[model samples]
Target: MTEKISIESNVMDERRTSGELEIKIFNQSDKTRTALKKLALWWGLSLISVLLPVVHFVLVPLFFFLGFFFAWKGFKSEGQVLDGKTTCPHCGNNIKVGKGELNWPVTEICQSCARVVRMEKKEA
Candidate 1:
């Protein structure tokens, strides 16, 4: 499911700003579904690569192995960031953070002023 969380952003200049972030946490069934989808996509690519002449020798095997690897990774994933809006500490403009795998201390570039912003969960 989705959760709203408080976050803090740090600018290169040492300025800190507070904001909110939205994240998606996958349940067991969701993880399984994601893993299956990833596996199907990669395996499908491998099947398509079989139509290629000499490239199939390399691509087919690569995609076949990569499918299992990616599926395992997808199954292990706990959550992902959906999106977030935070103030750019440097430019004082609103910055939009894109989706990404769930990880602490997410780093993003400010679109308004092109400054780097480091984001982390806000401590109580």
Candidate 2:
């Protein structure tokens, strides 16, 4: 059986002293993520509108409004980035990742082991 270690978010920062790399990941819940995606879509459309001068005036404002709406929805939604860490199963080293890269626990590339590993939240 493989030993499992729990990493507490309270104790660790972006960088660890034990040769762990700092990474940024997403930590929002499904609803929040969906809302954020809406915001992103708004922004994308707004950007694209800028390229089309004929529709810039109308599309830009429209997209901005939609983006704000999504932002508000995401703000009201529950769930946030969980504070925790996981061990690199391949190299047996501690790995730190940002909350942005996580969503219901996902697989990520480990810097130390140079292998893909599933990163999950550790209950404190």
lDDT of every model, 2 decimals: 0.89, 0.56
Question: What RMSD does model 1 have?
Answer: 2.2
Best by lDDT: 1
Deviation of model 2 at 112, angstroms: 1.0
* C-alpha lDDT of candidate 1 relative to the true structure: 0.89
Cα shift from native, residue 63, model 2 (Å):
8.7
Residue range 18-60, candidate 2, lDDT tens digits: 2222333324565567677878989999998999968899999
Report the Cα lDDT for residue 15, model 1.
Answer: 85
Residue 67 error, candidate 2, Å = 7.8
Q: Which runs in model 2 stand beyond 4 Å of their true positions?
A: 1-37, 40-78, 120-124
